[model samples]
Target: MGFTVRQIARRADGGEIIRTRAFDGAELSVGRGSDCDIQLADLGLMLRHARLRLAGDGRVAVEAMGGVPLEIAGAFVTRADLDPGDNPTIMLAAHRLTLARGEDGGVLVTAERVLAAGDGSDAASEAQVFTLKKTLPSKRRLAWGLVVLILGLGLALPLWVMAGRQTVLPPALVTAAARNAAPVATPASGWQPDRVWSSGPLSTAHAGLANSCGACHAKPFEATTDTACIACHTPAAIPAHAPAARLARGQVPATGLVADVHKAFNLPEGRCASCHKEHEGPDGALQVAENFCTDCHRGLAARLPDTRLANVPDWGGHPAFKPTLVVQPSLTAPRFERVALAGARETSGLVYPHQLHLSTRNSVANMVRAQGLPGKNGLLACNYCHVPDSDGERFQPISMEKNCAACHDLAFARDGGVVRTLPHGKPEQAAGIIRDFYLGQALSPRAGVAAADRRLPGSEARLRTLAFTSPAQARAQADAAIAGIFGKGGTCAECHAITDTGGANLLTRFAISPVTLADHYLPKGRFPHKRHLSYDGRTGDAACISCHSGVPRSNLASDVLLPPLSQCATCHGGPQLATAAPATCATCHGYHYGESGHGGDALRVRLVVARRGE
Candidate 1:
């Protein structure tokens, strides 16, 4: 539990002086400084040189505090466990210490000088103390031996073997397939001794080039440059990520732990290897972590105060999407503007009411059911008009000739067993067509009225009733027919915007504005109609219309009846949102500008002409 120390000193006359001091603590400290319990005057001792502590088994454990080891039983050691009664001797600098059991079952330490101070400077004893002839082999000898061994085996021997090689081995002969051609029993083709120096095997992506390392390592001891990889990963011809790396780095937070680490490593900003790291065993999926995006995007306003983008921590923390809508009436220069879908409207120059066509009891639905478009109770489904493309990722561009012409027939005349239809999308030429039809009929009228009797209810039956014997009379009648059709309640003017040319008679010079419908409403978001056709199955019928709540009530083509953000968030939200479908920014947003890379409702298009084109 305690220790007592006796310091012994010798005078010049060979007389000794001893002073005993008691220390009542669990441990004892020895050193040359006055701060230690057993202080020595010798300059060779350090301040707080060693410590002696009582072990649980009642043995005294001595340990050096400084780097120097204490000499115990002629052996230099930093630590040792010994019994006090055995009187183990320790040499700390010039002092000789002995440990013994005291009368009170405590530790007793006695210290004395082993040699006289004057004798340490003697030339004969100094040579014996300083010489290290047989202590161990010289470090220079071992280092030179290792150098010789490495040069002889690791380099020189290999070079010598290479010099003796009669013929240079082509890369094709060094391949793993070639190396394994001979039997394993002998040093045959499998003996590619140079492979022993490789650090590791090639990754699976580059495994084929293992025998041809020169493809990338063109110069030894130099790293492979990006030019070696760019030969394979060429980006699309379209504009790619920023050409200036500073602009890319500007998005990263200027001060962060990761940024500090990257700075310490002298890593430049915005390299492809940051996210596209390879050689990670080659088989695992190589998806970038969400933090890669959130690092620069989360709290971006604080780091880059001037940016217009909202800080999006994740998918659930996104701002409301402003959907792109055609905002101009002119087809030649239609301006697209992004507006929040909640209360926005489009400017398409057509007048279609979805509710009227999709209603269960409407005439449009009756006609649609007659054509058998997967309807019930005489209602038309969304698929009747909005047909999906071949991949079902998006709807094909709506075709007036296919979807609308079935019911909105533009028949103006009839021959035997054939009803003639007007050409669509050429409203300016409609007047000429009407004039020619009547003139041809005036020259050669059909033999019977039976052909005209079979025409639909809205056909130009009244025009056929007019009695015309001359081309001038037929021309006058055709003018009346064109005006009646281009004006209100006429077939051509019902869906299209018709206008009478300035300073011209409405009967002869009326022009209908071409109707333009966009293939995509939102260019920044993507919607796979196939995936969402059953999003809300609450109702047995009209499952697709539940989220698109406005479609059933929307009557105007310019209404832009996209569902509101609140409606979509009900099912799709941030990853942390408590729902069946959890999403993140990657769920609907993209960090890059590739059209194919963008997800969500970013309209993926397959341009199809009659023979299809982009």
Candidate 2:
């Protein structure tokens, strides 16, 4: 029932010099008055400041003697319960008193003057007359001031402005808000007034919605709803690396305590902002790390058993590439199929014996060198025909006129300083020109006839008639010429696969080569050739043949020459792999549809909106 209160004090040197007093007290009087059981001489205290005693129910009670109250537990109160065993301390005026259990069930009281009394003549002291312990305003005073400032400015001022807005708001908006019983914002004064509650600056991308805090945090201090985001970001949903159902559908459920708590809260298993958090720092939006994507994709096969997606983790753990190729030989009817490039074959019609043309000692290379051609070192280079586009991302499709016409000539007939060239592509037209030439020969006067051959002027009409041949006979001669040119060893047959349309009754009809070449092999993955031109680890740049090793020996057009993933892994591999590239999940695979999505990120369009000044 009885206890002691010991007061601890520090001297000028910061040493703990302690002094104690044991007062015989089931009841004690503590004041500046003479008759008080505990006397204290502090100018700030009244004659009879407070009375302390043990209550009938075995608890200590302290009460003010008159109207003046004592500071109890940092609060001013007229009465308070004190358990000395708890080592309770109370303050009166400039003096601090502590109560504690003393020897033999008696209570001990300790007192010390903690602060200097305020000088009455000072201008600051005149403002607060009764304050002695604190010459300045106390913590309570400052705390109350802050509370008033927040409520009056952050909340109350905005409410007052909103009320003012309601009067002038257009009838349309006012009626809409009233009809729905919702507090919708109307155009207000320049001062946003409510921005005092804004946590921090919005990301540079989202800075357009800065003034409109309620655009996201609609409710006061409440979590943002999906509706807030969906309002503007409807079609462009946040990229959720993997589908939501994979992780959200747990079988036996999470067993750990933290997991249980999370489950109980029904926290979103796949929320957009979970990974893309905002208002963190001065830096705008930060990109999510590789762990965000790998976490869901690592063991995804087990989670979603029926998923059609190829089970792949990060770039290092990717599966073999699947390249799309046209299965049908003709462009008239398209058919596509994705097959692994390692053993994939192409059925592009023309046959290209790569070794014959590329060989240094071969006849074709020798002919190219004899002409002092566009190639280097008396040999054909890949770039001689495979020219890159303006951007150098990929090669332009090869053209016969631009790339091949220099070595091949179209001339077929020459007579008397007049040379006739057969049109390169038109077989029938070239034959007709040949037939007309022979008809002109039959009509011309013979050079050896001399005087007799000049029987001419009067007989010109007769001679011209002899030059014209029967349509059937002329067609037959033209067909023969066309056949010879389209045949196996003809000029046109050297490079192309010749096919006759089987016109037995009619003449000859030759069909040219049917070939289709794609500049890009893998449409889904972006491989910037410019970036890879210098991908050799130690040396500055690697040759194209380093990756396409089969190109030098690839004789047939059917050989699919794309390198396998193992070739790329020599430099680009796992972080722990010896290679320095350390490829991650984002190197090749894009999560979205456009160039903006090439790096698995959305294009953050920074709107240059005019900001409201502070």
* RMSD of each predicted structure: 15.6, 18.9
Weakest 10 consecutive residues of candidate 2 by summed lDDT: 449-458
lDDT of 1: 0.64
Cα lDDT listed for each candidate: 0.64, 0.59
Q: Which candidate should be chosen as best, given lDDT against the real structure?
A: 1
Where does candidate 1 stray beyond 4 Å?
Answer: 1-229, 242-246, 254-267, 277-286, 302-306, 329-332, 449-466, 502-508, 536-541, 594-614
Scored against the true structure, residue 311 in model 1 reaches a CA lDDT of: 80
TM accuracy, model 1: 0.58
In candidate 2, list every pair of residues with a backbone clash: 3-100, 3-101, 4-99, 4-100, 4-101, 4-108, 5-99, 5-100
Model 1, span 390-436: residue lDDT tens: 87766777777877777777777666556666778765576677777
